[model samples]
Target: MRIGCRQKMKSIIKSFNQQGFAILHGVLASACIEAVKRECEKLVDELATKLLALGRISDTYDDEPFEMRLIRLYENHPSETPTIFRRELHLRGFFELFAHPRLLTIAQAILGPEIRLYPNYSVRPKLPENRRTEVLWHQDAGYTSAEADILRMVNVWLPLVPVNVENGCMEFVPGSHRGGVVPHEKDEYYLRIHDDHIQPVVAQAVTIEINPGDVVIFSNLLFHRGLPNRSDHVRWSVDFRYQDATQPTLRNTQGHLLCSKKHPSNVVRDAVHWAELEFQ
Candidate 1:
């Protein structure tokens, strides 16, 4: 690796080790960002067409900006708006961002050379005035089985649009990962940390405001939540995880191998190959 690139990677790893999270600014190329935006636009357009055909919406809202289009379509029918897109993630744009070499290198810094993209990848659209989009405070590990505690993993969150407190930016409790798994309860839409544990650290919470090309890498054990979208537009972001290849995912679905020094043949070759894999 080049000297400058190596230095940046080292800094990211150091920050992650100390704070349980790190932010890399402007890491993604403009072309990659535009591609993902285009894909999001296509998805919204398809949904609008379907809603119109069903007489749920009178217009497709085709001319609206990407941030406002989704919000307008689900104005009357909030339940119809998708909070997460799990299937069809093998699309070209998603695959490009998923397997971007720079991102994989950062993952490699923390997870060694062998890395596997975890199966729980998602693209979230946090819409305005939508209760479904308000995520509660909890650790990512809380949602997984107990066996997952042993899995060495890191999560990467990249926003498609600018995210701030009003648009439901994520908030994190610094160094909270040092505390193992806390008790969580099933809430209406998400699992939340118990009040006793969350209250003490709530004051330390930091709202993560980020731009389109910035990426936030945080520990799975970190306490975090997505605030409500009070702004008029949608907050679009993609989140995915990378785990050490040698560890078990604790789930039936084995995620795709992203990189491996010992067995390079296992790594995903290109976007076309990614499109062939089934969503797990």
Candidate 2:
């Protein structure tokens, strides 16, 4: 059953705790989505301009739709195409999405009221038939560090376009978080759960198909993977995490705090304030 934002949030919370994940529909507005898309277009435009100056491409592909713009820009240079973006996320347009009240509330329930935007946030553009974009089954905790396994946090995934099995939507094994961190082995480009461990639950995996306004919140220990993008266009998405602020980030750069009762003055004040800060 699809869970809408209007439905009782308690049930969504319940589902997250019981099943290790929950898909919340209609969690964002059209304007909010558009803002992020515009920012994405701007980023692509910069890349196109740089490529143009380098005489890599003759056409900027400015008229192309958001879904195809990046694909068209890098059609001749797949090797140079970027699959992940991180440092450029400090733009003002992303502030609303990061500090969204509804999303923070859910994070607060899973974690505590003091929420810190985890340092691992990123925007991934899954390109068609690109091995670099294909992610294998692995728990995020295993990728971070041993201490990250104990970090109280929730992962958030949102799409900029419609997603399905064809365009590389996420797939998760329900209730997989209860098993703790499973053994993960390195793959060609990503990490895959040990065959012996994941084989028993492969049949339980479910495809996560959602739209721009929907969000998938899951545990860091949840078994999940992104399918190959077989479509003609790109599967654009952003994923981030919210962790309890009281704990050490175990990294050189500490993420910004979204909400905190102990040190309310430190929370990101507003969109402008968010833009002023770096990814640290």
Candidate 3:
């Protein structure tokens, strides 16, 4: 690696180690960002078509901006906007983003050469005033079963549009991951940390704002939450996790390998290969 690139990686790793999260600004190329945006647009279009067929929407809002079209499509039927897309992740654009070279390099730095993309990846669209889209304050590990404490993983969050306090950007309590898994309770929409545990660090939370090509890498044990979408437009973001390939996932399903040295044959070869693989 070049001297500058090496230095950058070192800085990211250091931040992650200390704060349990790191922000890589504008790491993705413009072309890659646009490709993902186009794919998201396609998804919105498909949803609009279905809604029209069901007589839920009269117009598809084709002329609306990419960020606003989804908002308009589901304005009348808020329940229809998809908050997570995991099944059809084999779509070409998603594969490109998931296997992004720079992202993989960062993962390798923390996870070593062998890395597997966790199967719980998701594409979230936080729409305005949508209760289902609002995520509660909790550690990512809390969502998993009891063995979650033993799992080793890093989460990558990439936005398709500018994210800030107004558009439901994520907020994190620095160094919270050091405490390990705290207590969590199942809320209506998702899991949430106990009030006593979150109250102490709640005051120290920091809002994470980034551009489309940037990425936020955080530990699975970090205390974090997605703010409400106070803005008029949609906040689109994709989140996925990477785990050390050698570790046990504690589950029957294993995600695809993104890079490997010992077992090179296990790596996902291309987009077509990813599409062929089952959701598991």
Every model's TM-score: 0.96, 0.96, 0.96
Tens-place lDDT digits, model 3, residues 154-271:
8999888899999999999999999889999989999999999999889999999999989999999999999999998889999999999888776777888999999999899987
Write the residue-wise lDDT of candidate 2 on 1-280 in tens digits. Answer: 2365436677888899999999989989988888888888899999999999999999999899988988999999998889988999998899999999889988987788899999888888898999999999999987877676788888999999999999999999999999888899999999899999899999999999999999999999999999999999999999999999998887888999999999999999998998899988
Total clashing pairs for each candidate: 0, 0, 0
Candidate-wise lDDT, in order: 0.89, 0.91, 0.89
Error of 1 at 190 (Å): 0.4
**What value does the lDDT take at residue 161 in candidate 2?**
92
Which stretches of candidate 1 lie above 4 Å from their native place? none
Candidate 2 residue spans exceeding 4 A from truth: 1-7
The weakest ten consecutive residues by lDDT in model 2 span 1-10
Q: What is the per-residue lDDT of model 1 for residues 164-258, given as tens digits with 9 covering 90 to 100?
A: 99999999999998878899999998999999999998999999999999999999999999999999888999999999998888888888998
- Model 3 TM-score, 2 decimals: 0.96
- The candidate with the higher lDDT, 2 or 3, is 2
